[model samples]
Target: MPISSHLSQSPEGDTFVKIRFLAACTALAAATALTGCSQLAGSADGPQKVTLWLMKGSASEDFITKFTSSFEQEHPDIDLEIKIQEWTGIGEKVNAVLAGKSKESADVIEVGNTQVAQYIETGGLSEVTLEGLRVWGSKDWLKGLSDPGSINGAQYGVPWYAANRVVIYNKDLFDDAGVKPGPKTRQEWISATQKLDKGSQQGIYLAGQNWYVLAGFIWDEGGELAVETGGQWVGTLGDDKGLAGMEFYKQLQALGDGPKDADEETPPQAQVFARGQVAQIIGTPSQAAEIEAANPALKGKLGFFPIPGKTAEKPGAVFTGGSDLIIPDKTPHRARAVEVITALISEKWQTELARTMSYVPNKTTLAHLVEGNDGAATMAVGAAQGRATPPTGRWAELEGKNPIKPYMTAVLTGQDPKQAAKTASDTISKVLSSDR
Candidate 1:
């Protein structure tokens, strides 16, 4: 998806991604009709087609249409077929297709950063290396996105666009509460939250069960989601450092209001805040688009800032959540597929992609594209301080299949942070070591 765009929460707290993803059978049928993708049976005598699977709206429709046309013009002998996949169960769909190494899978696929490690581990994706990344602006690639594209020593994915969480506050509410737009330090942040909680308005809203949010808290505390040493993955959250981070997260929970009952799929942060019930939300820049679309009155009332660190000069470290493109290991025209990937991340495409979609470009040098824009600017600084969840290939399973969110929710609801960390850590250790 487009920097957690697939994870968009609707006004009523529904997972909008669920609505976009079709049943596997139906999606395959539609994709077949649209792209006439092959089952990886054999090479064609004439123009070879490179199948690309992506979410329905990962990029602007206009961008995709124009880019595809221009790409075909340059590479006349090759046909680029885009097969749209749903965010829901895309991992599994890719999993099934890549299992036997047939030509049926997409030549280039847009995989979520969290899922990249697992795909690379399974030998499903071709190893997209750091040297290969040079063709796609390697020197300027965002570390948070590119790092997640690798597992062990080989890169299997290339950084696409990215998104980092930033503070989106209601300017009117903040001014009325006697607080300012961007609180530079932690103390100021807490005070602002408390003040906002006084009137009819609630304070900051942090989704208690969102693991991505949890990972950011860990990074801020100088802890990590996991660590690898001596060829083994170990869960570190059970340690003193990790426990301290979890406890800090608990303190933030006390200052915020959110739909904790919604499990890992927290209420749409933008929608809930748009109703004028919440004062601040640590949210994606794209949320601004949804907010304005639903309630036009909020356009100017909303203001954004990168969450500050302990001091004023630094932005808080955040989990770099976004999309990545990888070539399936079995792609026949690997060289041609790479050319398409290169074009997608080119300076021209990335600039327009970031501008139209409000995403952080894959390249650090492109920050100027969002220079004066508050929401985009906030995300730009955030990407600078961003980090990946973990490099473990089983990270996807650890996050989705494990009890990490339940553990965080428990701590938020009153369980001791240390105990919660210990429990979640044990599960993480098990998941990360399972494949080994």
Candidate 2:
């Protein structure tokens, strides 16, 4: 008998309805079976499975595979199902899943450091407290990297890896400009930039849209981007400290030392620097990997230092942004997931991941693990010593609407410094108010 004909002659004439009924029955039976099995399952695991959702593509694939294989070897009864997700529009996807609209798609998720706080605020992540820290062995795991992901004293994520900005300069360009090799004070930074600005090549190349780069300067000057006062967000970009920082950026723009508006893309900064079109750039140490991939010939010619500031005593700050591992609140296997996370952060795994990814390890001991390689160890040490900017939940939104970059664009394109600073401060105040 044909299936459709059989269904039509049966109690349900509609084939669609019959199929739906069958599916419903199957689902119910499966749920009951799983419920019964759940009662029988315990820590003396015969078989345990964990599903991890990671950002899509090759970046996470190799790491996940290697890590999972090692873990499964250690615990033969455990199995890992790795799910790769596209990062594009991930926030909306996470929101939908958290709203109970989608089935629980992930047991463990990788979140960016900047987004971790917001995820915790919305209850999207499980709370990993000081008690949870005990499970991970010690409380001493990269507290600097982990603490930023905490809210109101409860940690939401563990540091997977971190990256921070540094000053990368073309040594050939510097030598050609007759600039001495050494650290530069804030005044000397300005002077060197002016001197390096010969006709053929500019002295510096600042990314017009990079707030991370801008924040470093602001932090060095002790400027507060936003302050929580009386349970409300208040603007501080117009204050003296902020104004001083803005002035420094504006001066760089005025000197024709930064990139043009069209060159705002990160690759072009590396490209221009490699081609000797720009003398210096403020970029993350990970750019070493980027430069190698893009322009291998320019590798040995690069000189890196912690970014300079107005005073030698205070090095310019770098925005500490990196990836974090978090267990979702709805995870089915919390204890196992936590164990996996701890294993990943262990000294052995951290050293391996750091060496492979050129990322800063959360463990302090892993800082020296990448030594003798091409400047990666040195860069890690520089980042460890540099001051990190305060992270805010609304950083992404505020950065998008801020006029600091636009004002920077104007200044680089020949607007007056004072006018640019004033315009930037006004726009910053508006952005700050909107966040409240």
Candidate 3:
């Protein structure tokens, strides 16, 4: 999705993605039928047909049509087939295609950045490290998107566009509290929030189970949710740095009236902020629209800044959430597929995509293209320091009934932070280690 697009911090975002995915299936099928299906591999003396599976809404129909025309003009020997897929059952769909179990297969597939690990585990994605380094300057790619696509030292998924969280504030509330807009460091941010938390006006609207925000803080303190030790994944939230991060979270949460046992989606934090009593909230810049719709009076009253870090040097590390492009290992048009992907991620196309969609570019160097947009510009400041969740297939399972949420709730409600973290860490270890 575009950096300007909104995806919830809770499971509701997953639901939204699924709906967009399923809804496009029929539309795409009708288009393919009208155009007629192209041969998968075709003949050696004939033009090669390269199939691409992209998620619905990833790009506009106009963008796709333009790219297809230009790419075909550039390479007359190869024909491109673009298929729009849905997020709903994409994992199973990708697996079936990679395993050669599905009748429809794609040479290149667009998957979530965090999902690369699971697909790599299936032994179906081709390694593209050399191409990423020599042709694309892989070193310049955003850490959040690049790191997850790499396992051990081999790269499976290529970095695409990215989106992360930022501090979205109500300008009127800040002005009334006599506080400034940007806080350079974490301490400065906390101090400013303290001044903003007057009666009936919360400093921030941060729910207790907003673990995505917590992930950034923990990373700022040099902690990991789980780490690999001697060939096994172990949870480390009970570590000293982890607890220190939680302590900071506790301090910040006290400045607001957000629920201790609920997440941002329970009552929808955007709606709460729209009520006009909150000063700030940690969310994607796209939520500003939701807030505006709930109360149109606040349309121009919103502003955004990168999430502050411990020091003034850079923003805190956030969980880089976005999509990645990968190639199935079994594709017959491997060489041609590489050519197509290289074109899409090149500087020319990357800039076009970012500018057209208001997305953070794959490489931080290209971030300047979207500098005119407030939200994309703010998100790019922290894109270099972005991190993804544990690169394990089982990680998605943890999202459902996440142990970290209860641990956060317990610590916020006055339980012993150490004991609560220990319980959560133990569950994380067991879950990551399980096969079924």
Candidate 4:
């Protein structure tokens, strides 16, 4: 049976409407469908078809199609067909397919950064030995980009690209408030925020429920989410460093520097920043473009900087986001897939993708390929130098249960920072300890 046949049917909800809504915002869903189908590349005597599962969206689809077209031209024998699923629905769809006996339909797949660890833990990923890494020469891969896909020294997924967050500040607001151009330390960040806080405009625009952003501060303060003490995943959010980070967020919130309630679905931090309702914002590189498009008047007035750390020597933590390509455990075209992956990560392809998508390429050598594109290069370099968040099997579950953003929201909304941190830590510990 085809993998789609085995999986549960889509819910009766207004799928088309939802997809249209997402498409209007970013063309992400449209890209997924167009690229989900594959086209054969190599000689006609070789394998005729290769099936791939990818997230829905036009950008993803376009990327896949463009890359596949190039790969096909180089090797015309292989034909590729793509299956697209919404980003929000991909996990459940993949899980259902993998749980069933029909694994043949899924040959190549794309997994999100956070979803990768969980999928690996569930044996959803095929094991790729260190020797397999040799196919895609080591020199071409970025260290940080590949680290997330490895578990206990074995590689499972090859990084497609990386997206790191940076602080985007409104220079006009800074100038008006007499704040400095950039913040070099945590203290400087705080002072700048205070100075920028006007009655109608906030000094800082934060999404109250975004734990990923919150984690950067915790990490900047030299804190870990779970410390591996004697081979145990122990909670660390209640520790001194974690508390300090939480308190910083709380102070900002107390001063009306952030939203009282914000979430992945509803918070409009980027929009707020673009409209001059906020002076500073921490967001992905794409956000700069969004801001420029939203408020053209703010073009030269926008300034970019890396998130501030505890000190100059310690770089602030950035939550890395992006897609990665993975071959399923029971794929019939393993060799062909490997060949394709190797080509995709090549310096040539990496450079092209980086240029078109504004994604950070996975190859260190390709870093220079983005020479004039300083923004993307900076994010890529920071990711290479910074530490990644804890990679655990239950990360998604933990995140869902604890919802770090809400805890930060509570703290910012005048709840006890220590208590909120303790509650969040306990919830995360429970989630992590439950399964793998």
The candidate scoring highest on TM-score is: 3
For model 4, the run of ten residues with the poorest summed lDDT: 16-25
Residue lDDT tens for model 4, 190-221:
88788788798888777577666667778777
Q: After superposition, how far is residue 108 of candidate 2 from its true place, in Å?
A: 1.4
lDDT leader:
3
The regions of model 1 sitting more than 4 angstroms off are 1-46, 96-105, 130-133, 259-266
Q: Candidates' lDDT values, in order? A: 0.71, 0.60, 0.81, 0.64
> Total backbone clashes of model 2?
0
Ranking by lDDT: 3, 1, 4, 2
> Which residue runs does candidate 4 get wrong by more than 4 Å?
1-47, 58-65, 96-100, 137-145, 178-180, 228-232, 252-256, 385-389
TM-score list, all predictions: 0.84, 0.79, 0.89, 0.80
RMSD over all Cα atoms, model 1: 8.1
Q: Give the lowest summed-lDDT range of ten residues in model 1.
A: 14-23
Between 1 and 2, whose lDDT is larger? 1
Q: Candidate 2: where are CA atoms >4 Å away?
A: 1-46, 57-62, 131-144, 182-184, 254-263, 288-299, 310-314, 385-392, 410-436
Pull out the clashing pairs in model 1.
39-104, 40-103, 128-155
Q: How far does residue 382 in candidate 3 sit from its true spot (Å)? A: 1.0
> Compared with the true structure, what per-residue lDDT tens digits does model 3 show for residues 212-234?
88988999999999998876789
Give the clash count for each candidate: 3, 0, 0, 33
